[model samples]
Target: MCAMKYGLLFFVTLMATNLVSEADGDLMSMIDYRYFRCVMKREWKCPDSEINFFMYTPEHPRKHFIDPRYPKLLHDFGWDPMRKNVLIIHGFNGTYSKSPMTFIRDAYLSRKDYNVFMVDWSELTRFPCYLSALSNMKKAAQCTAQLYSAITQAGALAKMITCVGHSLGAHICGMISNHLTEKQYKIVGLDPGRPLVSAYGSRQFRLGRDDAHVVHVLHTNAGFLGESGLVGHADFCFNGGQKQPGCKGHIMRIARCSHFMSSCYFAASVRRSRRLVGIPCDTSCPKERGYWGINPQRRAVVLGDDVPDGSRGMFCISFENTEDCPFD
Candidate 1:
């Protein structure tokens, strides 16, 4: 009788301990990723080893799109219907639950007034740090078809399509960059991984002379590209990349940081910041005013002589304030 009692107590203690020590993957509350990015602020802090552990695991992402409520908000705020699109891709370790595209879709849905998208071809996925070689790049590039497909699904008339990629996600973004747009697309690479540019080669990461006018890489955690790459941005801005406060850097938040989520922080901020408008100019008019998203309240857009006077179309001005700015 005593032995049976001891066994029962032991089993109860075991269950209690298991309940108290939850694994990172425990499905309880939805992770507020934006609230816990790699920066070290009061809201987002984690041990270094956890950051590393988080990157190696693969989370199959559920496919997602803009939430329905977004359009209503855009209409409420008086946004233009004819505007461009922006696609945000997450890096290796940054996926939502099981779906790599979850937060990406969340980003699009975050600002429903504008055309936004998430790009994923998990079938061709490679290890996060493996961008040091092109050995698997050929297989990884197969995702271009999906890339083209998603762009078509978003809108064929979109004047410009910008690709924002981080870390390995940037490499994945680079893989399809060649075909992500109809004419030329814009690309924003944030702390692009070291192996990414080299493993994929420069051809994999490019912004055409006529390709949407610009490409930028925020070099905070850039292990390879020098400080100049950060400086070279026409609108180059730093995230503090993997190390910004509020969001823990990968090196520090290794447990929570993944190749996918690291760059995603920067991508999310940039993706939601632009102000989009439409201008109905005659086809004969040059594609003068490039599409941009301005808060129309907190921020301003000052076009210069250098502002892509490139041959494009005229833009109609209509304010589409980014709904509840993601960075906020």
Candidate 2:
């Protein structure tokens, strides 16, 4: 059994490394050597030590590490109970500092309206350890839930908070509800990881429509790195949700770019709400121009941060070219 376990580990590592090679060049440049050391050291069992909560507010733009164990520290760090809170979680092979997830963090900070808290569990979800990262997700979620409780105990309302996550982090956002007495008010899942998650993950372990009061999912690489079909109350598929027009090069590279684009699109939405709009379409992207016109009766739905809480069903948005889409 031990030999089989090690062999499986070797296989997963090899496969993940090959997969990472196909990612966008920009994503490749962001890989921190520390993640390699963490993966090599087999730091998969995410204890309390592996998870951290860093709070950022307009008053204190710099990150202030807040321990979930000390809920009162929130007050000490200039956390304003009056402002809405947003918890941002990064995905596999991601660090709070370098990953594309930082786009969303900065967008929220620029608005100066939210008390932003970024959950950094990079040590637990390092690269080339996809299986281990998946294993660590529940512990990470449980730890994040403590932070949620800490924020609430510090006088923030649960209804005024939003949980935003990318890829595996998206599922972590959903799983956070498992440890809480009540569900979160909102959750925006950016291209929730597909791999083992879509095929094997249970509802409790994956992002689902019922995970939050309003769950919005942006699919930029569906059927590949991102989850396909209707996975949330509001699902937006950009450029057919397969290959983003803005991405060029090999198919895998495009897929990676597309996967990362989910966060980019979302961040843009936060900065300019209601700017990106989608029309009601089938589960997939509309085939022709006539298809888009066929649904004149259905009102076009806004995508991204300003998506109406009541919006439901699959929506599709097509861009004439890369310039038309906000994929920065």
Model number with the top TM-score:
2
lDDT of 2 by residue, 171-264 (tens): 9999999989998999999989888787678989999988899998999888778888889988888877777766876767677777888888
Model 2 ranges off by over 4 Å: 1-13, 20-47, 285-294, 320-328
Q: Candidate 1 regions off by >4 Å? A: 1-83, 93-104, 126-142, 149-155, 175-183, 205-212, 224-242, 246-328
The TM-score between candidate 2 and the true structure equals: 0.85
lDDT string, candidate 1, 255-282, tens digits: 2232233344443553444332222232
Local distance difference test scores for all models: 0.36, 0.78
Give candidate 2's root-mean-square deviation (CA, Å). 4.3
TM-scores, all models, native as reference? 0.45, 0.85
Candidate that scores best on lDDT: 2
Location of the lowest summed lDDT over 10 successive residues in candidate 1: 49-58
Global CA lDDT of candidate 1, please? Answer: 0.36
Question: How good is model 1 by TM-score?
Answer: 0.45
